[model samples]
Target: MYQHEPPTEESPKEYKIKHARIYILLLIGQVLFPNKSGNTIHSKWTQFVVDLEDCGKLSWGFTVLANLYREMCKSVDIKVTEMSGCVLLLQAWAFTRMPIISLVAPLQAPYPYARRWCIKKLDYQNNPRHHLQGYRFRIDHMLQDQFIWRPYLGLAPQRHEDSLIWSSTTYIICFHIVEMHQADRVKLQFGHLQGIPEEPQCLVEHHKMTTIKARQKAYTTLYSDEQNCWLHRELFMLDGD
Candidate 1:
């Protein structure tokens, strides 16, 4: 009933450049350009986003979500559902650790169950809003939050109910949370991270390597898994149909 197929080739950089560029030009730039004037619904993707944003119905997205909201609305005791929706899965753990909504099979609620919270580790490590802190390239993107370090964009797995399924869309619109505030890609490369400003004026940098054991050991304590997780234990992302 199930099967696996190894990839014939993988060139993520090429794919992302093409895919991301086209999307910006067509969907966002065409429709929401600051100065450009388009009176009609030139792009279907824009229309869908508006419809979803306004209609608040299940007519827009192909997203996976936690069950907390639905359960709360129904007054049913249930856990949240994490990691649902989209087809392109971004396991940033292996890549640049960019907090993009890489797709995966829509995480769904199982049958005959009230709730279960399963997705955990992946959620905690990817801190949300770290793009502001400027660490899409840093393996450890923990940021100082008041007195604690939080995952740049917390990516904890969510809990869910016993009934959910995946439906197709003409296209899925995923909002990438990472964009360069600093232009000149060369300046933003991994090498320049050393010059990043520090808050308490004590943070230092170590030369990275294929295996930066000493560096990691030093930085590991910078974050707290218990206190400043990126994902909320009680409220998971409740993406809808």
Candidate 2:
């Protein structure tokens, strides 16, 4: 909390505080509004502060982040629970010739297990662009030296055209991990990804098509197969719990 406003009414601080408070209240309104209909949180926050009369460029960054922090605080429900531990699931996509979807699942031990897979090519093509690629999902956990990217099956699969693999794989892996670890709660977080392509529709079309059923089947099959393989591998590692 940067306090630039003076406590005295005679000071310019009085005017600044009044105006700033008005904008802050509107921001709070947006955050608290159920079914937000306006611009995104970041957009509204930045615009509100920048649009304020006489507000300068230098303080904009700080104010935006700070107000966002305030809103997060307001929204978070501080609850007491019996479970003592929690895990965070971070998902991010990297755009390239063939995009990569990265997932890091939390284990009971001090470190986490990561997985990265390439998205399927939705459009049929004679000359396939890429086969397989290696992507390192780096996490700056605690110390700079303590980063782990293991179960390192580099991005490979490139067949199905629906392009639902990324979201499907994410759900499958997350469900398996949570069930295995029996985590109290999972904090789903997204990374700042850019230039990612839009999600593709179901591959089969024309005859009585339902996206839900097709995606459900794909997710289930993938999860079962992957889970079995993952568990078998884990059993061999003496370090795993």
Task: Pick out the ten consecutive residues of candidate 1 with the lowest summed lDDT.
Answer: 176-185
How close is each model in CA RMSD to the real structure? 23.5, 21.3
Deviating ranges (above 4 Å) for candidate 2: 1-35, 39-58, 78-241
Candidate achieving the largest TM-score: 2
Clash count of each predicted structure: 25, 0
Model 1 global lDDT (CA atoms, 0 to 1): 0.28
Tell me the TM-score of model 1.
0.16
Q: What is the C-alpha lDDT of each candidate?
A: 0.28, 0.31
Runs in model 1 deviating more than 4 A are 1-42, 51-55, 59-159, 166-241
Winning model by lDDT: 2
